[model samples]
Target chain A: MHIPDGYLDLSIAAVMWVLTALVIGLSLKKVAESKNLNVPLLGVISAAIFAAQMLNWPIPGGTSAHFVGGALAGILLGPYAGSIAMASVVAIQAFLYGDGGLIALGANLWNMAVVNVFVGWYIYRLLERYSKFGAAFVAGWLGITTAAIFVGIEAGLSASFRYPAFVAISAMGVWHGVLGLIEGFITAGIVSYIHSSRPDLEETSNAVISKVPVAFIGVMILLSPVFAYLAEIVGYSEPLENVAEEIGLAEKQSYTGIFPDYTIPGVNEYIGTLISGAVGVVIFLSLAFMRQHASAD
Target chain B: MHLLIEKTVKSATSYFQDFFIHEYSRKTYLHDVHPSIKLLGTLAFIILSISTFQVKKILLILASVYVLALNTGLDVGVLAKRSSLFAIFSFLIVLPVSVFERDVVYLITFPLRVFASISSLQLFILTTRFSEILYGLKKLRIPGMMIDIIWLTYRYTISMFRDLLSILVAREARRLKKTSHIETLKGGSKSLGLFLLRSFEKAEEIELAMNARGRKISYRGKYRAGFFYILYISGVATWWMML
Candidate 1:
């Protein structure tokens, strides 16, 4: 599920980068603000997860699948720390093994680190009161399936990818949805075993929501249509522009931005997006920080 | 059952060993190049290569990277072998689409792009130490806390992998009879559960030890961009121009 380079358009990659940085920044802040910052624990658990990934289990039909454990991480640790842990694992894989591409690292992180961890954590939390094993099984299965769907979305949106969005989504979604059963069982087994052995360890999840992240997320959601307008205004069609055109959305309504395609005027689209992305991140972070400070004040 | 156990153990052992290969290698000029510079350059090359649709330029970049790999004392054959495997894997992914679209150009170009990208990345990995790369990320202004976690993860990955090997050996030794695949999976999951518990215990011990020492995990390194770094950048620039 790691996206190698040469697969995604730069625009989609840049958008993912901004989103990932936002989540990681918030996660780091959340982890740091905790009473006891057990950095070592996060590290070791990440290591365990990485090593455990190497283990292949026999399936019924003589095929084997490895455990992903994104949901397991979120269940074991809280979402904040889990995100950081998963991010570290993903980053190491890319740097050391080139399992994914540097250019596409942002999207990879967004998928595995942010989406996988959070979706898994939220699902488990929502379902935990009913049945611990069932929650974990569902979380593990759905977590990876959701992440794979995001990968499909990113790939489908990229002009570099030949397939349409629906095909990509269905392919990745269906494949992982089926493959995720093994992950589900593995996660359930681990959680139930750990619950029986060391119940105290399961109590480490601290999922208290602060006002800042919620407000920041709200602001980001509100900003999307505006950014969408900006994307239209700039006159540079993004990878998603193809989807819009195919759906006839591009022809119906129109808006424009001074910077087309989210790039600075008169600059290379790639570098322009990089510059634009950096500025966008700074702006978003500043807004989030300001909101945080205002609430504190 | 034994084959499964042995294959898992061997693969885990090799996976652990693969992390340390650069640590024991002879130092070349590529080793002297600042990791941050190499990192930035490598990322630039990948981005440029991927963004371009020119198959000719992509092949040229692949050839140039292979030549550089040879000159830098890297095993070109090994690099080719690994990259071709990746290329074939990536090609298989696009096979259905190519068959549907019947686009020969798409079939040819996608794998070549993947091959080139993987080759360039492998060159970077085989040359630089993972720690230096982490430090480079630091220089690149990545969060220090994230870098610390990655370093710790790498360190403990080795330790926990050893523990895992021990558990697998113990499990295999104790197996009284041949088991069905389902039974094997059940046993494996039990070992994994035990492994997770041990990892938690290990974390608690390490945390207490860290608290006692009042030491923080940090990495500090010097980065000097030398002749090779400059030449590499120039080559990248030339490739960009050609594209």
Candidate 2:
């Protein structure tokens, strides 16, 4: 799960760094808002997680898998604190151990910390209402799966990387899905034990989201196709296409009609692109708006 | 299974201990270099190595890394052995590109890049003290709280590692039967849970002790790079630009 340097294009890595900085900044604020938060406790728990990762449990075939502990962190601390702890652990691994590359830290943190912590936290929060064991199990499973998906996308998006997008996705997905089940059972057992012994430590708070931000995200999604077309216009081909050409593979044309490069086929290229973008924006915004209204109700 | 656990514990403990000993025992020019300079040099080396795909440039960088490592009084054999797993993993990553794409340039460049980057990082870690690095980071103005967490984590990792070793030994000594895989997993989980519980308790004690002293964990050091470090850095930057 550790992406080494040169695994991603510099541009993509820069973008990930910017995104990571924003999330970490937000997490810092969130953690600070908690009056009872013990900063040193966060450090100690992170060290514990790092040490615990060294312990490998035997699987059926004689091979063993170490615990990731992201989900466990989220269960004990809320998402923001969990993200901070996981990010610290990851940073230590990179800077001290050289287990991961410095340049790729942002992308690695995005995959392993932000995605894993948030997905695990939210899913556990959502499902723990019904069954604690099931929540932990599914949160751990989905957390790793989602992280794997991002990893595949990041790797496959690099022209320097050899694997095709689908190949990378499928391979990462299948392998990590199995790994995730192991992770799931371990997380469930840990959480179950903690629930029995120290229920007081479990996080009870949920992250609050203002409607304005949700609406803003919806608008951004609606305009995404336009951004995509603009990106294409700037000679930025899809990562998959870039890699294909790099490897001497012939570019295959699937569809070049109204949605050629995600533009409206019948109109002028720019106009067609705008129309397609508009359509995508409307569809996404509508879905988001509906979800927001339903949840509010 | 017991042997595996014992080996894991031993290796992990030794790895940290080795790092600690090497930082204190080694005395060389590189060791005296400011932590910021070494850190910047490491980052520059990695960035420059990965910035190009030219075989000649990559090889030159690799040779330069080796020369630097030797100058730093590191044993090349030991460094290579320590980094062997990473080298093998790097080879595996680009193996598919070599076979499927048959891109000779990529095939040659990728592995070299990985090796050069890893070696550059190794050079930095081998010579610099962890405390010095943290102090440099503090001077760089990374968030204070984050640095606090990292410093605490580093301190506790050694202590908790000792705890982990003892736990593993205790488990191994108590076990008598040939347990099934499921049983082993259960036992592993229980031990891990107990280890974590102990760490939490120890953390509470540490927090109380710090509070009692009315002091926060502060990384205070007066280490600064000299003119020579700047000159060397400029030379590297110039070489990178020429590449």
Candidate 3:
């Protein structure tokens, strides 16, 4: 769902960047407090979103399936952390999986992270005011659908600009519109199950926020290339083979050719592997530092 | 050879989109020109390029901008690669505009044109520095309030995220952090809720900071760029002149 760099027009992407920044600008203050609001719990939630996104499942009719990036993260982390968490996921996808380009990072960040967190959060909340489980169902559905439409329209826009002028953006929206229906339903089911079972999560989140630590910063400085090897292992591992089976999503990924066997080597691969390590380290250490400081102050 | 160059330029725009291309050896001259010049120049070209794309004019303006860009000391190879990424992203964003499905030329041109105009703006930012552009913006009266907010937000965001990471690290260390995978999940949900509450409070604090500093526009009326301002006004005039 991350629409990496070099995929769209520079001018259009610029507008999206400004818009994304505005949202983030507005979100910056709120996001900061979130650190103190949730605690170490944000880390675990980020990790879960990361892990879930990794396993691209299949839709029942046979296309590929990826996690509902914004919806799932938003439900747990709210919008701010959820947006960043999803951005982190896209970054890894670009570096480790070579899924999207770098320049397109802003666009991808906007479409996948921004849309998922903000758009999904609102839509989900709107549905949930009526029933407890309804929030999850709505969030998951809207999150994925919104992302899909964003991607499809972006494609049509690019095509019209590039070549035959008449080739409209909505031309492709039909495909995504259909996909959104299925995505919404599946996501709703998953969210309903998870949120319903874990009621404690709804309360007592802020107790976890705290200040950052020095040792963790040291870790970020020392970090480098281990994730590529890890990705390779993950790509070949059969343990996940059974995951889809359990969820009955074995059909989703198989149809779309989502799981491509990637060999991570060369210049870009080296950099990505190193950066992913650094990013992970940075986040972990940052968490450590915040926790210590939050308690002391 | 001119068409060859145009074709090459078109190809390069797409090239910028593949992987995140970085600034190559072209960094030697780094802003041998002023930041304000580069930013304004980039913005101007972005306008022309975007207009050309939307007008569906013979790609003449787009090609001319590309040709002009090629003459600069900046690394063409790297830029070519970088531009394409934004192009594709903008491409996708504009793609959905077709959702109106009516095939209105404005839907086709205006929105796409606006998007392209800004992608060029992004290119300017990446190529330039925040300080220089802020100087340009300040000189141009783009609104100090927005700019200051951008600066403060960055400081606070870094500080806050840094703080959050430390907290999570502590939880990891407690008791080998073996709170069952499920317990870990509980910890996460709690943290997110807390994070939201704090984020709201932080927003209020920032607002107070702005207010204490006196939240008035430094240039509310006519911009204060002296003679340089006249040239900028004319440049914008030239842009509208095309329309």
Candidate 4:
């Protein structure tokens, strides 16, 4: 799951860096606001997580699975401190062990630390009201799965791997889902032990539902290209024509349109590209709006 | 099963022990260079390598790194071995790209860049002391609190690793039969939980000791950059610009 340097496109890597920096900065502020922030505690826990990762547990078929512990960290500490702890471990892994690439550190941190920790924390909080075991299991499972999805998307978008987006997603999803089930069991066992031995340590904070809207916006932005690609495949004739030609079918139309290859009829190529993009966005937004309204009703 | 557990514990302990021992014992030009300069230089080289898609530039950087590693009197074979797993993984990752890419140059470029980047980092870690690296980070104006945390973590990790090794050894010695996967999982989790509890307790003790001595956690060191440092930085910058 560690993205080595030169694997990601520079533009994608830069975007990840900016986003990770912002999240880390916010987490620093949040942790600083707490009066009794235990620096050594955080550090030792980070070290423990690092050390624990080396301890692989046996699975069936003579194989083993090592713990990533991102969700476990979030469950032990809150999201803010958990992110910091996981980040330190990740940074050390790169700097000390050369386990990950220096250039891709930000992307790795964002996916492994920020994404997993926050997702796990929120999910745990939401479900803990029902069952502690269920909460821990789901948090661990979904945290890893979500991170894997992002990794798949990153690799797919880079196009360096030549793996189609769906292929990457499905492959990573199935692999991590299996690992995640093991993670879920481990996380639940740990959480249960902690609950029984030191009940006071369990975090009791309510889930913050307000962040959902912001996450929705982020998802919408991320999926914009996918939406555009889908529109091109469905609404336009080029992809169909190409597929038809590949299968030895005759062309439906011999002539090109005014907007050839998604270009506007009378505009410059750049402007036509913009117009086509705007149209795609409008279609996606309208569909989203209708879905939201339908769900509300 | 018992042999597997013993081997795993021993290997983990040896890795921690061997790194510190090797770092402390090594003496070479790289060891003499200021940590901050070495850190910055390595980072610049890594970024420069990663930034380019040309196979020639990547090979140039890799050769330069090899020369630097040899100059440090470090075994290039050891460095290569240490970095080989990631290098192989990187090659495997870009293998599919090679088939899909129209240009043959891309096939060479991606894997070579990964090799260069990982080798450079491995060389840096091999030659640099962990404490010196922390000192360099402090001098670079990293936040005091974050640095302190990293420093503490580095300091405690050695002792915690020792404690963990002992705990594992004790558990392994007590085991009399081949264990099932569930049994191993249960035992591993128990040991991990106990290790974490002990670490937390030790942290509290260290905090109290620090308070009693009225001491603050800070990196104490002098950073001196010589002519070679400036030349190194300039050379890397010039190469990056040329690329």
lDDT of each: 0.75, 0.69, 0.44, 0.69
Better of 1 and 4 by DockQ: 1
Chain B only: TM-score of model 3: 0.50
Collision count for each candidate, in order: 3, 3, 88, 0
Residue A23's lDDT within candidate 3 is 49
Candidate 1: segments with Cα more than 4 A from true spot:
A207-297, B1-4, B172-182
Per-prediction TM-score:
0.82, 0.80, 0.41, 0.78
CAPRI quality band, candidate 3 = incorrect
Q: Which lDDT tens digits does candidate 3 get at residues A1-297?
A: 555433345544554555555544444445555544332234334444443333333334433443445765665566665665566556444432334544345566666777666666667666777864566656666666666556554543443243222343344346555655544554555455445555554442223323242123222112211221233234322222244345432332222221122211222556535544543354345334323322111
Give the per-residue lDDT of model 2 (tens digit) for A32-114: 77754567888898898888777766677756777888877777777777888889889888877777787778888877777
Fnat for each predicted structure, in order: 0.47, 0.33, 0.00, 0.31
Estimate how well candidate 4 is docked, as a DockQ score: 0.15
Pairwise DockQ winner, candidates 1 and 2: 1
Flag the better candidate by DockQ, 2 or 4. 2
Ranking the candidates on TM-score from highest down gives: 1, 2, 4, 3
Candidate 2 ranges beyond 4 A from true positions: A203-297, B1-4, B21-24, B165-177
Pick the winner on TM-score between candidates 1 and 2: 1
lDDT tens digits by residue: candidate 1, B13-83: 76666687646365655666678887876776676567556566576667767766666566888788756
Q: Give the root-mean-square deviation of each candidate in angstroms.
A: 11.3, 15.2, 22.8, 15.1
Highest DockQ scorer: 1
Model 4, span B121-239: residue lDDT tens: 88888877777888887778766666667767766766776687688778888989878777776677677767766776777787788789874775665544533444544544333
Q: Model 3 over residues B173-231: C-alpha lDDT tens digits? A: 56352353334334533443344344445555655665688754232222222223223
